[model samples]
Target: MNTNPFKFGTVVDDEFFTNRKEEIGKIHSILSSENHLILISPRRYGKTSLISKAIKALERPYIFLDLQLITNIEDFTSQLLQKTLKYYPFEKIKHFFKSFRIIPNISLNPLSNEVDFSFNPTMSSSVILEDALNLIEKLSTKEKKIVVIFDEFQEINKIDKNLDKKLRAILQHHKMVNYVMLGSQESLMKEIFEKKKSPFYHFGYLMQLDKIPYEEFFDFLTERFEKIKNNGSGLSKEILEFTKLHPYYTQQLAFNVWENLIKNNSEDIKEVILNSVITHDNDYERLWGLLNKTEMKIIIALAYERKSPLTDEIRTKYMLGASSTVFSSLKKLIQNGFVVKINSSYEIEDPFFKEWLLMRRAN
Candidate 1:
């Protein structure tokens, strides 16, 4: 039996990773120059995978922190300190604690053989954040370059409004550390980094990740399916079109197809698609519940047309009510990640959701 080669809902290593050659090279070059980078994409566009691949190509010391897992400033500072100490040399760690005037008791996890440092909780959040910044600066003074990756960095906005300003102030002067801030929320990331009034304005080279090219993805799927000796003929194209080349969904659909193919030699792509939607029915139902009626109509219109909903004919046909309502609903959907603005048009972010909506309309 061939093991399923597709990976979804997690970061895939180079073995299963398909493309992004240009992105990897560009990111590597940016880090090599000790420059900061801001990578933006909608969720599941493989921002994390691209970063992980790029980091593997680099020879520098690096730390990757997922801000989504961090709830507040205290969590951020503690994780920052812990990851820093974990990656830095033991002697340098000792120097770090001494220089920062912080004492942490060290413990080792027997199962993972991982060392963890726990510091006293006497310091304020601001103080801890400042000290963490200081630690990065001090570490940068060493000969080796260090790279720091903040994944889902827009989550910082949830922790504190001033956190961006404070981080920018400290990071602006760091000479030795290169930073890559990855965010899946396009609007928020742009506001944080592109808006002139924001503290992180022009903070780094801004790069937006687009969906994987159709040809590239198709070739990858075809090759992997063939390697497993599975008769995946015509399935790759179907999966790509159905998933709209969204990385996560493509992998997920492909995974289901592979499983069905193995179990029953079933090549019914549409069945796999239906099963996938049905599996996530509850989550989709909850997502639908979150939107108001106007928003729902806009999404339905977009799902049906897959074009600009602001057009007169589309508005009339969908009974989108009024121009102002359409505009507000579209804005809300885009901001809330239910819809995405593609080139010259808008699309439902989740292709399966689009399918589900179409099925509902037909019913």
Candidate 2:
């Protein structure tokens, strides 16, 4: 493959991915102990990419499943079954799912390589999702110590309000398994796992993933870009500094600006990458429109003022309501996975968005 610049969506392995050594070690420690962990960060902080890197380092067998594509409970069941069966011959795992006798007519076509399990639970258990839990329980009994990592865990609450409760019970019963729940929405992930009232509370280690440091990222890109084009094209120290230190934005801006430079066949080295962000204000306006009144206020407030613990005085100054209202909305923003809270203070999660917020303020 022709090597270009490091794109925003590229998931670099342990060797290529720099910084966050301590965070990676923390996640490794959890999985190593066969314990569960909940990874919380707002969107674009590279939650999926980083966790994929972490899982790759694991010595144990692991399966990474994204919940975004799986909407209904039945889809969840079928996908899990398909992934599990994909590793082994259909004949071997066919009997594994046989006992879900509700799907009494289950069969695996050797030629098509499809496992067809036809059984619906009685009306009560069907809607209650007990049958789905039972199916997971049956799968858990296998010899493999399943590392069930659920990405976008916040979506579960939307699909089923009582999903955490149901899954917690089933997961608790399966001792041979470990879970790493990765969520970009810090607010929702926290509400799901940090709140005392939440069933998933204390189910796993509440680990917050912060952005990679600017200096480290600079050094990383310096080395990578040099490898790709030697002295013909490169990023400068000053330009890198102005782009902000957030991971998601840094990657996106760097990728965009880098592509701009490459496509133009010019490496002035002093080109203003901030122009990409400035000229692209419309892109962010659509995003701004998507936010609710409270969210918009918080974003605007944080753009100009970011204080730790987000006091009631600050909330009032921003024309926001009581502290609780701000807190609740902030939590929702965080859980929605597009923002992150730094030591109890909040900021837009994506590097590009943060930079965009700052650009809007300047305008």
Candidate 3:
């Protein structure tokens, strides 16, 4: 049986999971303590997988709730309670949840044999939230501490402005549960945890997941590619070189390259890049139609090896108009996750978008 050695577009785990030894170690160590964790990474950079790996290594019962799926405060409480029911026995926690002032409406999914929870929407949200959160402490024994992971936690404020204050107040008093909160949006996560006025400020140990170092990523790709072809390491370097070790795009490009090698018996990345561009052509077209003219100019300039888009040289060459206008456009791009601010330079978040821009210009 042959399966593609490279994978992307989902949580890469086990063999497909790339190198994040230090990160996993840090997360695992924090999970072992009473302190909570706040992990921030750009979308698809493998923060979820890192947390999954750490929890598996720790060999503890865990509950995962993605706040992105949460529609409101009631849904948040129900989702957390649902995952809790799956991890802990119903009978053990039945009395605890049943005693709530407003009892949760529980049902069993016959196909999956998992429980679902819902509460009366008419009840106060904060009280419902407190009851759901208390399940963490109730289910834990002295020896076995549970891990509750919240992914895309930046959505808390959107559910209700003061939900953060309420959640922080409840979570601070828990003794038997260790929380690991993960968020994708850099700016929002920063504001929620880094700002002085935010209730969640400094509530946990902060960590930012970064691009996999080139040295480690290069070796990872080379090892897998070599098994598929002789001296595949040389060819594999092109994937990293083109991706610049961006975690998600590196896997995406490698997936396409692996497909090219299997079907066409070639290591050439050029054809793969072109085919990828063609595959996403319509999406790029729509994106281009939506982008502001100033943004279009900046993207072109960056694609042309012109770094520091704010600089006078780039502004002059790209006809980017006033510096402040360029700054405002770039900020918009960054806020929308289209552009990433790296140190003193700015880069398009999607590597394929950058390639498509350059390719369109060439034609």
Indicate which candidate wins on lDDT: 3
TM values, all candidates? 0.93, 0.79, 0.95
Instruction: List pairs with backbone clashes in candidate 1.
Output: none
Model 1: ten consecutive residues of lowest lDDT:
96-105
Model 1 has an lDDT value of: 0.83
- State the lDDT of candidate 3 residue by residue for 130-171, as single tens digits: 988887778886677888898999888888878899999999
Instruction: Give the range of the ten consecutive residues with the poorest summed lDDT in model 2.
Output: 123-132
Error of 1 at 229 (Å): 5.2
Write the residue-wise lDDT of candidate 2 on 186-236 in tens digits: 666777888999888889788887778766887877776665466522473
- TM-score-based ranking, best first? 3, 1, 2
- Every candidate's lDDT: 0.83, 0.67, 0.85
Q: Candidate 1: misplaced stretches above 4 Å?
A: 101-122, 141-143, 228-233
Clashing pairs in model 3, backbone N/Cα/C closer than 3 A: none
